[model samples]
Target: MAEKQVQSRYAPDLMAGQVALVTGSGSGMGRATALEMASCGARLALFARRKEPLQETAEMIRAMGGEAFVVPGDTRDEKSVEAAMLKIKAHYGRLDVLVNNAGGQYIAAARDITNKGFEAVIRNNLIGSWQMTRAAADHFMFENGGSIVFVTAISTRTALTGFAHTVAARAGVTGLMKTLAAEWGEYGIRLNCVAPGTIKTEALGRYPIPPEKWHELNRSVLGRMGVAEDVAGTIVFLASRLGSFITGEDVYVDGGETLHMGHDARDMIHPDMFQGRQRGDGKNE
Candidate 1:
């Protein structure tokens, strides 16, 4: 007789009837994470500037027999964020999970970064996430506990000259996570982060790296780039019962990119002819 292989039935269904707020949840990693949480039965609260995409996410959750509420708001605006939080609280009464995943950056070298671009990135990515966390923390404190997951980038620690503003902002988020973890532990709140590596989502188009450089970006401890699921799953875990003991830590889902430290700076000086690699599989971008 053939025997079935035994596997651990470890399902962290910690979010049933729990309210989860996801920002920039219309597409890419944010959307994926929201959908995953819904699959596990958490009622979702989605925030994004675009209505159509946020609605799309809500539709997916509804299709799965899960509940979701949509709130369109600009992450960079404090009033907008507060209003969004108020709307969620009004709809659900309590929030169990908060994922600050909305972020952006101008992909230029430090020398070419403009003041406007720097300020914009800092305001939207760092300050916006801070406001969202603080607003939710006030409610969680009274409730005695909650979870927050910040979507940072592996590039923050393994510095790249092209993303100066994003790096600084995300580094600040790391520090914020640690501070809050200590401050809010008595409330049973766990604060953490997830840093993703080269992912092939819609945002990947924004990075104007040539084929050789793009390929080099994947030459990490692991040889291939990760998809949205790789990073999304980590966020779900961090916010679930499985990660109850984990906090004040940032998990990197970069397929070993940080372990590799990226390619040498001297590689940038190589002639195009010498590099002999083209973007778009030899098609000019």
Candidate 2:
């Protein structure tokens, strides 16, 4: 067989010499983004709470003749974030991009979510992203400058039932990105958020969403569920020179899901299905 041809919309060296750190890179959007960036010639620092998954991501990058460094740590912990940044600096000597993709939230109605549950989601999504962003800036981006992308949910565009906690947390991240972009623009640092709609990933399986109701999750203009690459492509664009002029923006990779938001929530959210579930028990969405 002829050697398989590889096709990419982006220049192979679009991100040459740049070092990017992607959290939650063990699988799903995180892994997809890392691989995409690597293909564009960006050295990767794979991070997540699990070492094995990070290693798996690193292996995939290596298989493609790309460079990858694994730095396993929890994004929600200040110390862990700091240590991960230090490790990335030691390994790559510089950082150019940071993708805050490490976050999770269980499906639960507002009334069923306890204060601890709410706080956990906030810490994981909002506070953890803040921590990673701050550490990256202090360690490398402050004077050198870089791009920061936060993976948020399109639910921020409209209220998402059974995901009140995540919507709130992701909304906070959106606000944080906007404010920081304004504050960091003088430093030549670009900050933005990528709010993805329901992307088909392993995390979706954890939700107990019935196969029949899965169609309801794709209530977007595209009339199809999104895949990780859908969001990963947008993120790579924002982090590359293509989006140098873009900042303080929340690009929706939702296939126009926001255009008809909440239309399917009634059919999808099964309160009973979420019963007994607590925060931190959810998988990455």
Best candidate according to lDDT: 2
Candidate 1 TM-score to native: 0.85
lDDT of 1 by residue, 1-285 (tens): 122121212243656778899999998999888888887778999999899989888887777677989999988888898898788878988898999999888678898989988988999889999998988887554475888999999877877778899999999999999999998888899999999888868887767766556766574556777877777788988998879999999898988777666555335654573355645345644
lDDT of 1: 0.83
Q: In terms of TM-score, which candidate is strongest?
A: 2
Badly placed stretches (over 4 Å) of model 1 are 1-14, 210-213, 262-285
Task: Report residue 129 deviation for candidate 1 (angstroms).
Answer: 0.5
True-structure lDDT of candidate 2: 0.89
Q: After superposition, how far is residue 38 of candidate 2 from its true place, in Å?
A: 0.4
**TM values, all candidates:** 0.85, 0.89
Local accuracy of candidate 2 as per-residue lDDT tens digits, 1-285: 122122447999999999999999999999999989988999999999999978878888888889999998998889998998888878889999999999999989899999999999999999999999999999999989999999998888888899899999999999999999999999999999999987888888888788657777577678788989888999999999999999999999988878774445325664543454533434432
